[model samples]
Structures are given as C-alpha cells and as structure tokens.
Target: MFALYITHPQVRIDPDVAVPKWGLSDIGSARARLAAESAWAGQLRRIISSNEVKAIETANILASASGVPVEIVEGMHENDRSATGFLPPPEFEMAADWFFAHPHDSFRGWERAIDAQTRIVSKVEAILAEHDPQAPIAFIGHGGVGTLLKCHIAGRPIARQGDQPAGGGNLFCFDLANRAISCDWTPMESWKGESRKG
Candidate 1:
C-alpha cells in the first residue's frame, strides 16, 4: 500500500480574502476533476485534507469518484503567512526563498520554516499511526508544508529544491509499511499509482 501527499492546484487569489479561505480557480477545479478519474484516486481508501478551502475542494473532487469522505485535519495547513498577509508575486517569491533559506528564522513574522516542517511531519505521522496499512490513502494540502514533509521523508534538510512544480496539482508517494518514499513529485492526473524513486 502507498500513502500520497498531494498539493492543491492554483487558487483564486484575492488580496482581500484570507489565504486559508481562498477556493480553487477554474483551472484548479478542472485539474482536480481530471485527477479524480485517475486509477490512483480510485484506489484511495482514505482522503485526508487540510482545513483550508483550496485543499478541501481538491480533496472533495478526488473523493467524489471513490465515494470516500474527506477527513479535514486541523494542523495540515500551509506555513503560516498571515504575518505579511498578501505580497505581490515577485515579493512573495523572494519571501518564500528566504523562508526556505533560513528555516529556523521567521520571514517577516511568518512561521519559521523549521516549525512548519515539524508541524506537518507530526500531523502526518499521527495520521499514519492510526491508518490501515492495507489501504491506500491521500493527503491533500499546500506546497510549502508538503515540501517540508517530503524533505523529512527523504531524510534531507528543508530546501526549495524539493518543492513541487510551479502549478501544483502534484503528488509523491511513500510506502505504507515502512514510510519510505517510493516516488518523487508527479502531476496528479498522470501518476496512475506508479511508484518510481524519491
């Protein structure tokens, strides 16, 4: 069995809206629909999602095909960026770079990258601890913390090098029995449940 960590695709970015409340854009919803029809989505026995709207929307789309309920987990959110609210694209990218570069330090009052990594890893471990090894599961979340979790799984230090592709809607898989990474990031619609390398 395998456990997949999936990142939500593009979202409707509204400066006035709280980041956590942002929903999927049209493209994101379409991508989720495509992924929902994949073999991997059909094989999922459990679908866990972050409470964020975008994540929940992605999880629901994937779950619709399998009829599995989306389990919204509280602490599976993205690295807290509420401190700076919304930054323009270039500035946001720079801030993100700094966030990864200095994992132990906060970027403009944002949550420290190290702390976010710890939170995501702990949440994932707790979920896996109670999960059935015989069943396949999917966790839907954001890019930042998802990368953090990937770093922990790969036994590497946190770095932006491990982040998903620009558009998101990607996933990586790990073995359920040993929690070893079985696949690197792949577009969700194209994965087909195959496991390659970390």
Candidate 2:
C-alpha cells in the first residue's frame, strides 16, 4: 500500500480573513472535484486532513468520492505564518525564501521551518502508527508543511527546492511499509494511481 500527501489547490485570498479559515477558490474546487473522480481518490481507505478550511474542503471532496470519513488531525496545518498575517505575493515570496533558507530561524516571527517540519512529520508518524498498512491513505494539507514532510520521507534536509508547483493541488506518494517516496509531485487531477502497485 501507499500513502499520499496532497496539497489543497488555489485558495480564495481574503486579506481580512485568517489564513486557516480561507476556503478554496473556484478553480481549486474544480481541480479537487476532478481529483476526487480519479482512480486514486476512490482507492483511499482513509483520508486525514488538517483542520484548515481549505484542506478540509479538499479532504471532504476526496472522502465523498472514496466513501471514507475525513479525519481532521491537529498540527497538520501549514507552517505558522500568523505572526505577519498575510503578505502580498511578492513580499510573501521573499519571506518564504528566507523561511526555507534558514530553517532554524523564524521569518517575521513565523514558525521556524525546522520546527514546522518536525511537527508535521511527528503528526504523520503518529497517524500511520495506527493506520492499517494494507489500506491506502491520503493526507490533505498545505504546501509548506507538505514539502517538509516530503523532505523527511525522502531523507533530504528541509529545502524549498522540494516544494510543489505554484498553484497547489499536487500529490506525492510513499510506500506504506518502508516510508520510501514512490513518486514526486504530480498534479492531483492528473495522477491516475499508476505509480506504485499493491
């Protein structure tokens, strides 16, 4: 069996709304719906999601298709950026670069990249500890922490180079038994569950 880490797609950007509360944009929803119809989604026996609105929405779509309940797990959220609230794209990009470049340092009071990575990895490990290895599972979350988790699974140091493509809705799979990555980032809507066989 394989476990997939899937990032929520584009989100509705609302400067006044909390980042965790922001829901999916129309495009994001459409992409998620498309992913939900894929063979991969239907194969999921367990769907774990962050408490963030966008992640929950994406998880719900996949769960609906898979007939699996969405399990909202805390600490699976993106690296904490609440310190600076929301920054415009350009500024956010620069901050993100700094965040990744200095994994031990906090960017504008945001959670240190190293810390976030540890949290996500721990959360995932705890969940998998109790998961049925024979069943396929999907974890719905954001790019930052998802990249962190991916880096850990691949045995690479935390780096933004492993980050997903620009608009999200991407997924990467890992073997359930050994936790070895089976695939790299691929758009959720385009993945056909063809990489790793049971």
Candidate 3:
C-alpha cells in the first residue's frame, strides 16, 4: 500500500487574536487548492485531514474532485502550542528554539515530540493496516507536525527537525509493505518562488 502524507500551506492566524485559529489566508488557500489538485489528479485512493478548518478545507476540495468523502482524523491535528500561544514573533522563535532543543519534552503547553510521534505513527500504522496494499492514502496536516511525522516514518531520530517553510507544501509517499519512504517531500512547482519546506 502507498500513503501520501500532506500538509496545509498556511492558515489565517490572527496575529492580534490571543488564540489564533484563523482559516487559510488567500495565498494559503490557493496553495492548498493546487496541492489538492495535484494529489487528486494523481493516484490517491482516500483523503484524510485534521479537523482544523485549514486542513479540512483543503481535504474537502480534493474529496470533491476525487469523488470520495473525507475522514477527519483527530490524531493528525497540528502539534499543540497552547501554552505559548500568541507570543510575539521573536518570543515565539525563542520558544521554538527551546522546544526543538528539547524534543522529548514539551515546551510550555506544546506537545512533546515523542508523544506527537507516537500518536501520528500509531494512527498512520492503523490506517495503513486497514487499506489495500496497492492503494494510496493522503493526509492533509500542518507543516511542523507533518515534517515530524515524516521523520518518524523514515526511522529518523525524533529530535531531528526538517525544513518547514511558510505557505509551502510537501508530498511524501510511503510504501507500507517494504516500510520505505518511496518518496520524500517532493516539491510542487506549480506555485513558484515559494520554498516547499520551512
């Protein structure tokens, strides 16, 4: 079986709002549309996404075209950073640095990398076990969480990080039977000038 792990480009996070759960921005929505178009136009058998508006919106678009209904998976939601929501950019950066420095532990209210890895990998494993080995599955998630999940699937150290550029998208294909990342973070060039990883 093949699985396509994906992520939403960007969400409309209200900088002024203390808790930002804003929907996708104009550009973000565009990127998501393109991502969906690319995946649905290809070989994805099913679509899964986090319940967040941004991811759901993207998944719905693909589902509409693919003639399949979306399955909202709670475990696929973005890594929670509730403990440090709405910090100024600089403070957020500093906190993120600290979080990365200690991946096994949570910084503030954010998810511990180990916990996130466990949940994501477990959920994905269960899904893979249920699907036909010849079919492909797609997931729409957040950038950071998506990259971390990819690392887990690749058998890389959980503490290591990957690029997660803003307004970018990644496509990874996992071959279930062989336990291989058949493909990793293939850049979608339809939307030019944007880095695929942050």
Index of the highest-TM-score prediction: 2
Please give each candidate's TM-score. 0.97, 0.98, 0.83
Which residue ranges in model 3 land beyond 4 Å of their true spot? 16-20, 39-42, 188-198
In model 1, the Cα lDDT at residue 25 comes to 99
| Segments in model 2 whose C-alpha atoms lie over 4 Å from true places | none
Writing each residue's lDDT as its tens digit, candidate 3 over 104-146 gives: 8788779887777777778877877787776667877776667
TM-score of 3: 0.83
CA shift at 170, candidate 3, in angstroms?
Answer: 2.2
Q: If the candidates were sorted by their TM-score against the true structure, best first, what order would they fall in?
A: 2, 1, 3
RMSD of each: 1.9, 0.8, 4.8
**Top candidate when judged by lDDT against the true structure:** 2
Task: Estimate, for each residue in 1-198, the C-alpha lDDT of model 1 and write its tens digit.
Answer: 899999999899999999999999999999999999987798889999999999999999999989989999999999999999999899998999999999999998999999999999999999999988988999999999999999999999999999999988999999988888888999998887854422
User: What lDDT tens digits, residue by residue, belong to model 2 across residues 1-198?
Assistant: 999999999999999999999999999999999999898889899999999999999999889888989999999999999999999999998999999999999988999999999999999999999999999999999999999999999999989999999999999999999898888999999988856466
Clashing pairs in 2: none
As for lDDT, the candidate ahead, 1 or 2, is 2
Q: Count of backbone clashes for each model? A: 0, 0, 6
Of 1 and 3, the candidate ranking higher by lDDT: 1
Task: Give the local distance difference test score of model 3.
Answer: 0.68
Give lDDT for model 1: 0.93
